[model samples]
Target chain A: MQQCYGSIIRRQRHFIRCLGGDRCNNSSSDTLLLLNDNTRMQSVMSRSNPAIEADALSILRSISPTLDSTKHKGQAGKIAVVGGCREYTGAPYFSAISALKIGADLSHVICTKDAAPVIKSYSPELIVHPLLEESYSVRDEDRQSVATVVLAEVDKWMERFDCLVIGPGLGRDPFLLDCVSDIMKHARRSNVPMVIDGDGLFLVTNRLDLVSGYPLAVLTPNVNEYKRLVQKVLNCEVNDQDGPEQLLSLASSIGGVTILRKGQSDNISDGKEVRSVSIFGSPRRCGGQGDILSGSVAVFLAWARKLVDKEGHTLNPTMLGCIAGSALMRKAASLAFEDKKRSTLTTDIIECLGRSLEDICPVG
Target chain B: MQQCYGSIIRRQRHFIRCLGGDRCNNSSSDTLLLLNDNTRMQSVMSRSNPAIEADALSILRSISPTLDSTKHKGQAGKIAVVGGCREYTGAPYFSAISALKIGADLSHVICTKDAAPVIKSYSPELIVHPLLEESYSVRDEDRQSVATVVLAEVDKWMERFDCLVIGPGLGRDPFLLDCVSDIMKHARRSNVPMVIDGDGLFLVTNRLDLVSGYPLAVLTPNVNEYKRLVQKVLNCEVNDQDGPEQLLSLASSIGGVTILRKGQSDNISDGKEVRSVSIFGSPRRCGGQGDILSGSVAVFLAWARKLVDKEGHTLNPTMLGCIAGSALMRKAASLAFEDKKRSTLTTDIIECLGRSLEDICPVG
Candidate 1:
């Protein structure tokens, strides 16, 4: 725990350096005092190896853009989710609309033709593209051409997107996976940030090279996905004893790609530092909460990158994005739970996104 | 701004002349006094080119018919919305249902065959007619016959409607627009008031002759639509320095048709006078709010027209309708926002319409 606190201080110093000494003067001391108090509280409350908790709310406030009348549509962020097939329309809809509810200027979903109309009907705010093709839809002879067409369609709008969220409702189809792989490569080439979740983790686990060594790529893996990743990369069983150390190793093995390992406490690691957002979340284990997190992460990642690019900030935007996204999703879930209790669904959590964001960083 | 206000008063007098003067004597002084107070407030606030704010709440109260046991089922209003296509079912549904919610006795939706069932499924309150046919459904050889058949279908029900809302989810289809143009002509012949919105605005902007010089026609244009209208009619860019004058000119250019320019503050004009409704409204810019406004406007326009016809009132029914509609929509939006906060969707705002109306003008 002492070593964990030391590492956090070191990371805090780096963040302070990025923000410049003059700008960090006030907040740095306050952050240190908060950390000291948290450490003291942890010593009294717990008798186990606790993961280093992150100041996710502060990170969220740091990255969130101020609402200005001068800023037009698509100025805050333009996020696109590369998912949604015949069987899984709600996942992409949840992710894309969650981005909009979280204050992104525009949210788009690139989905299979069959899913487009259904998703489009869900909300007029989303720009749904009926571009992806599944294996059953394409003949063996036409697979290559269809894949090429899908890539081309997505490529046309690639430059406009600040971030791409992959695999919320993305089903496991070989042809579709091939097309998404090509799309991922193109996004990587253009240096667009990505948040990978659900079946995207499946694709990445099998073909690690798709995201390996990509600093801007963020992989959000739940328990099963994380277990598979650990087995594939570390060639070992899941170790609960040194979870933070393993998560650190897992991220480091992926060549510094950030990993937000979702669980009881969302443990995030960018290899250099491992931080956990153990904030109060709803007990309701809803299916679509991960989709909301992916969407939230994409928006925050884009904003963080914008902040870094515009202000020359030194903090790892990917890590900051994961922390902020996790914290927000948890906050929204808690709020929804407070209202609906056990009946809270993913849509309820999504509806609370804007209010959660406003509570953290007011538009005014 | 003073000159603009003076011109509005002059136009108000002209409208009184059209309504036969005697009924204008009571409300005209009250409105002018409100304008005077607004002018004083504007000077103190150091505002430039301030629009003369209308007392929209009062207009809404005066125009809204009182509930009575003696009144028949359709006595309040019977509104028909001429929209909804394959790609859009929600917009027309929102408009039609909003009319019903805002005290209209009967609400009907004239939509394409593909959209009828879906719009009907949204609510049993709406009378959905899958009468309109798009180009895809009609062959080139059968175009004339199909259009004639569609017109005949709508014409049978035209006289029963108090007012027709001319576009909510009306998609841009050439054949459909042609059929709609024919329907517009028929409605004009019957002297039924038309509240044009969405694709109707698109249709009217291109073929201004469809609604040209029709006093019963009301064009509700949002920011983008308003820009297009200003470009097409005025042949210049939108100048905020002279927004009211430009809006008045735009209305006059369309031959005295009422123009409800929707924005942060809804600006209304009938070529004769300009009145702005800067009442409190939600900051959430979700889609379908325009649909609500169109429906609300249609109902109000019908009631205002009935009031004029029955009571020999001097106020311009169209102007009164726009002001009341704008005020009601804003109030509902504000109320929805207050409760739902950032989670406020168009549906949430629609739910508040009745409560908002009751709050403003309660039924004894």
Candidate 2:
């Protein structure tokens, strides 16, 4: 109950700051960090929803901060990718590295024992943990103990992560998926944001209760994956006609978990409103592109959530993150494709990410 | 579909206001739309194709947009090339990328699922959809369901496109051709213009009902393809002595669908008249030039259609599109040949599309 009122108080403080009350400062002293005067809190609570749409640009600009020397390492973001098994290592590495490239201060990859060394060898910048146990590695008798151990290890650092990207190269090992479910439940309890993609989508579709009604959950599905999702959630075939409206229904049905439907164009919705980012990216249907997208989204989402905690931006932070991530991913893919043509690989696109973000939102 | 018409109306208003009409302020109130005295529409319909022989320079000058900060994304045009397959990725890539370099704001490629990745690898500027299917990929039992899926995928994007350049590198697969036929029917219903070339000519030559009387359908066939069309429609051998008259009859035979007959001097007709674009060109007969011409024609046709919607341009938009496309393509080829001589390839000419257009139609 105290947690509920703390969030409200945060909102009240954000409202005061947004309205230019000038009662707040950059001090992080208060227990709940209320910088402004308390007089506006009652009036703000009296009203229902006080959301206004900025012309789109300002909302994004505000979400992405102007970094300075005053900022610390973790202040920008600490992102984690929770997927990697014996069968796959590249997927988690692509996703984790993408978060760092997109401006996240720290990127961590949680994977199984066999996958950890390979993923770590890909980049020294990544913090790889071999905490997950796949079915082949663990006997059925020890499954319960193993799950408890994995969760305890993850819980130790769960609060430090701004966002967790689930299901990069996460293979479909029954034991692994079951443990991930427990982690998801714990993350939900702590209210950590998640951007689910690839094999992670497979896990979520079957275990809807894991993410159902979780506002901070985001699902990025490819063309085929999206078809399956529509079939399962809407209990009907994917309606190509009225796609935007259908997407809205799907998100609402999932309790407003943001869905970024990846296709010829990207359409995003968080149940309340449908937004799309049609900034043409490279046409390469190469693998690993979606991993890049999930990681980029993780970083952007963390930043937007921070903005929501401090400022009174009414737009859904998940939707905004999807939009920014999609646009930057596409712009970078386009730039990579321009130079390399068909030879443009996911690594090449990853190489272009830093310049691409700088091009879109200049630090200066 | 409404958005397509709304864009035309916006272009009409912009064109009128640009011409110093003082007629419609930027009120966005559309009740005043049909109130433009009905003068332009009447003049356009009464002239009977008015083949007044617009000069080469003027045709291109009016076709290309004058680049400025005032322009919106699709204000220039949005073009899509409905082609590309396992055997033919480069053709669609050349066509779609040419549209972008020629100043179309957006360019897209719709190709077979196998071809999508390859074509996407070519450039990031084009939005590539892996929506098409092939005969080998589909089982006889799944044909119906697959066709429906293909059409639905294309339909969702049909209205957003200003023009579709069909058959650049489209293989002669029966299943793919059948699905494309359905797409043509859908595009005709939506009033989206199409420029047919390469294998598209082969498809329509056998299935005239696909284009039949659709006024916006553009069939751009080479000398050999034009001969087949003439033999199928007119039931006679080519009459070289009276090429223009024969071309006019072929277009008339197809109920006035625009036909751009390629040769040393490009001939265009829409049943009522024959218009020719004569420009000096390179002796190097290279492939992919036709793809560039077809893509260019699609963009020019969309722009010319907007001009007709406002300025009462008497010549059919398809004819103007062909004239402008043919002139610009030949000039670009000539410029590339001038520098590279015998070594000039299709890529060289594509590289010159922007400079060639600017030379003829300066932004200032």
Candidate 3:
């Protein structure tokens, strides 16, 4: 059912345009894609060198805030996810809600008008804003104004958000990306940290200047996304022999923006140092896990920035966020696997997050 | 083993229009979405105004009809769920199947052609009709004709269904919602009781005339949806300090229409008085539980109306139905949670529905 669900997601990812398109047209291609996925996972697993392992538990304990009775709601962390469209609702919903489940004080989703209700239906815990526009929904003449309105809507709450997790279900639409690019620029000006994953990486890779030299920006790319970034930024293929070195150079080329390359063992680099988190994660490679990672990174990043002293901290906030987030997600996934086994979905893993976090860093 | 497809394509999406369309978009800056939400939830938890607690178990036993060999299939109740789009299929299936499981004689799903097959694949028990048309499927020139044909298809079976559960996985397609609005009008004319939920609440919240003043219409709005409904109808924010009073006023403002405000404890009101069903429920906040509540309410409401002397019963059928349904759903959820713990999904709750209901009012 999960495999069928994964295919359904891939098939429906471009929902509005593909309403009447052939569902089984890509059968042979799907079979090949499945085969390639196996090979790719093995490849990803072999590439990471677990040489310089991150002190993930220590980082998690240090960055996490104590449960204070006096602190008001938003003091813990406030996260906003800029994604979800007519085509994709689950991805953004997964990311935004994961932030809440992992102890963020508040989570928000800014999505297209069509996507908002469905996403909101998933959980009322997240504040959903139906304030985005897609090309098909907007007139050509009204594009400029629509874009302006979209930016204004996001900007209203931009400063209030501790961090933004860009792209969980964000479709690759030209007009929507243009508006998001503008929003990213505003975030840059305001010094808001961003963790880019899923389609956000698709947007950031093509437009490097969006995060280039921005030390606060964190790019979390899965195997394929990492390959694309390596090819695009370094003008070369990924060499597994010197994995950490290649990752360091790629981050260096992007002028020190942190890159957490996701795989069997997650690798992190910010051009200054390289760290790998080799924590045990579940073998169930279900979809929507990346969303969980991105959301986890957003909260931890915010907290890490708050707790870590600028001069005294060994690793930067983004790096610390990636390491802690990676370790927690792995632990949660492992725990979910122990119970659900084959049926261990992203949702199940999400339900384990609080337990996993509490185990790693007990609250007083 | 499964049949799937919803076609009838884009003519002009959202023509009922989000033009000035901030319909569900928070008018209060979204940053305040957190401010109001945190305070309101805490307020709801701590409220102890000596609110009237409904005798839910007594209501359940009173309303439920006894199983007899002489009773025919359709005599129990007929339920139709009007929802499901390309983006969502699980919601309508959950709702329609739930009705059948909880003693409805026949359950039907009236959805877009594309959604019909997927919904059908979920269960053969449901009478799945792929008769609805989305805006994307009908062209501008063809919308009126398509809409008329769509209405004719639904009108044929309108009187047959004892109750219609509007909006479970119902996407926010303008043309689709327009057709649904027309259907709501027809159902109103037939004096068919409607249990409005999910996106149905969205449509009715925007255009209250559809259900306003109709004593048979029941609106089940979750915390956020209830907040929006109050803001729209009462022209004020949700004051958790006066939760029951606010609910009573909101229902009264809509001309005595029943409002089932879903929260920590389900608070119900039909203008005359407010009732709270403070039964112990599951702590797991999974999606699609609301659909189960809507479906359960539809079936119980039908039975309650049948058994209750309209002019003499202590509580109106809608209020009794709300109380009974709330109690049963909570019992089932609690059961599911005891077994599944935090890993419980909506399906888990649905599986518990029959057993839970039997425990309350057993068959001969």
Candidate 4:
């Protein structure tokens, strides 16, 4: 049964690769079949559908810069996560902290005044800004002024950021969401890469214009989020059997903005082509994992962009970023599940991150 | 039992040297043993005790670079720490700033706003950033937006770090812990070396997957931390009688990542072999001493790694790093103990870092 599943996945992968372009068309079924002797490739096919899985580990290694002593601080990457609120501090924390763990030299969080102390109390590791305001806290008369204050505070630090991870535990507040829309606009204007997830997806779904035609925007959506995106973009229900086709249309509809659909395996597209990350993952469907994926994708996207800028267009940095991020997340999740089993939490999967990357690409 | 320990150390050192090549076999083990003898091993097994510790001082002298005017800045080392929070700010400060006093040309600390000022106030030589946030300050409705703010702050300054020590004063607040976890993931993805200690140890313990297979990661754990790690990974209790075997098992279980178990004598293993560091440590076991160890470890880890990379791999950089760090910290503590006795404080020991290092490895 597993072998049969493997064959099906192998076939699908070939099909998708063919769609990818001439680069992948020449390496067809026979070549993949010949490579199947390697247990890693065989195992990839045996479990889940490998065709949708992108070559994430390789992308991760290839994109990872060599560690050198001469480099100054922050030369690797700098990231910001715009989330964390009263009821869901863990989400923003997960996003921001993941950026740091993955090699961003700096990580920051901008949240509400109430969330600041609590988030600050969580750890002195994060720079918590208490600039955001919600409807309940602001008087109706002060709404306009408070919005200005929020944007002004954020703008002071805008140009310094390499990328921003939006939506992790972002609750739905009309006023607060409005403030975020402005922030997103400012990020776009400044040319900072933005990775949208969670409530940010909700906001972007409702107002597609916020990220439309923005090449630096990357949306990481869960099953439900993808469904909403499909409905909004394609005006139709999600067709799982034609998952790649739908995703391609949705991304192209968004004007080439990247879309990473999260699942047992992550499927990513930048309108032109589709890539899947079918690496094994833990069965533990814990919460906050999505936040990790978003944060991770944000960092990789920024790194990829930087590489593209420096290398004068050698490869697709956005696709490479997605592949690396998805693979590392899945690999870590698998390792975490091995230890925690049914009891695994999002934290367990996070701890496995370093080891997972190391397994795929050993460091010296 | 003592002979068994020696054999284990010898075999492991041999393997480490083998990882480097034939030229390193003879001098590397003897020097490493000497350094180990003067640090962790000295305190654990008394000369009259059954287990004889190796000579650690020689190792320190061997690896410690001679001070020469011909050498340029940063040749000695460079180090960074990814930690600090509102609740605790001392960890990152101690870890990064300590590298400077121990002969590193540069040291940097990446922390949240609440902790950055406090940590910076603690020392002028260190570079501190106020980035990162927790949850309470943000409204439930604005988390996604806030997370973006946080990632942007850190993303602005990722990369320029040679090695990062995560989890110093890191608090366990869900929001902050989550962010720290992400930072670890990013570091691994970037292929940077990390030394895990304090709250960082806590993060890794719960999420072993983060550092599981990342060989560049070095985890330093105290007794309770070590106990929990053994229980979680090996699924057993701590065994004193079979310390070396158990340490080996623990390291191997984690897929070859280095583990430095802090006790009277520090035991280190990379799942290959167990080595002991017995050096000149004070009888006084004071609070905040671990901070010194962490900082020292960061410097030595960087230096050892530099040697490995530059000299074509003389030994397992991780192992050599542990040995050198354990020895230096012990020597400094012993030196401080002679002056302050029972009143010895962590700060006093920190003050002795330069002198102790100079005594062992003079730069003249």
Which candidate leads in DockQ? 1
* Candidate numbers sorted by DockQ from highest down: 1, 2, 4, 3
Q: Which run of 10 residues does model 2 chain B get worst, by summed lDDT?
A: B44-53
Task: Give the lDDT of residue B210 in candidate 4.
Answer: 94
lDDT of 4 by residue, A1-364 (tens): 6676556655765666646654345545535643654544554455433443455676787677654322433566778788877777889887776665565656778888677666655544456676788789999999999999899979988998889988887789999999999999999999998999999999999999999998788899998999988998899999876777778879889999999888766888888888777777878888988888887887777778777434433336677777888877888788999998999998777667656755776543
Global local distance difference test of model 4? 0.74
Return whichever of 1 and 2 wins on lDDT: 1
**lDDT on C-alpha atoms for all candidate structures:** 0.84, 0.79, 0.81, 0.74
Tens-digit lDDT track for model 3 on B129-217?
Answer: 99888876789999999999999999999999899999997878899999999999999999999999989999999999999899999
Residue pairs in candidate 3 whose N, alpha carbon or C atoms collide under 3 angstroms? B5-B114, B6-B113, B6-B114, B6-B115, B7-B114, B8-B137, B9-B136, B9-B137, B10-B136, B10-B137
Please write out the lDDT profile of model 3 over residues A53-161, one tens digit for every residue.
5668888888877653234346778899999999999999889887876667668898998887678667535667778888999999999999988898799899999
Model 4 segments more than 4 A misplaced: A1-20, A26-52, A308-315, B1-364
Query: What DockQ does each listed candidate score?
Result: 0.16, 0.03, 0.02, 0.03
- Off by more than 4 A, model 2: A1-20, A23-364, B1-54, B65-77, B362-364
Best to worst by lDDT, what's the order?
1, 3, 2, 4
Q: How well is candidate 3 docked (DockQ)?
A: 0.02
In model 4, how large is the Cα lDDT of residue B62? Answer: 60
* Top candidate when judged by lDDT against the true structure: 1
lDDT of 2 at A137: 81
TM-score, every prediction: 0.81, 0.55, 0.65, 0.54
Instruction: Compose the digit string of candidate 2's lDDT tens values, residues B1-364.
Output: 5574465456545534433334344545432443353543333223322122235667778755544422334566788899999999999998988777676766789999788756755543456777899999999999999999999989988998999999999999999999999999999999999999999999999999999989999999998999899899999998875566677779988998999888766778887756666567789998889998998898888888877333445577888888898888999999999999999999999888766876787645
RMSD of 1: 5.8
Distance (Å) between predicted and true CA of B346, model 1?
1.4
Of 2 and 3, which scores higher on lDDT?
Answer: 3
Q: What is the TM-score (0 to 1) of chain A in model 2?
A: 0.84
State which candidate has the highest TM-score: 1
Give the chain B TM-score achieved by candidate 3: 0.86
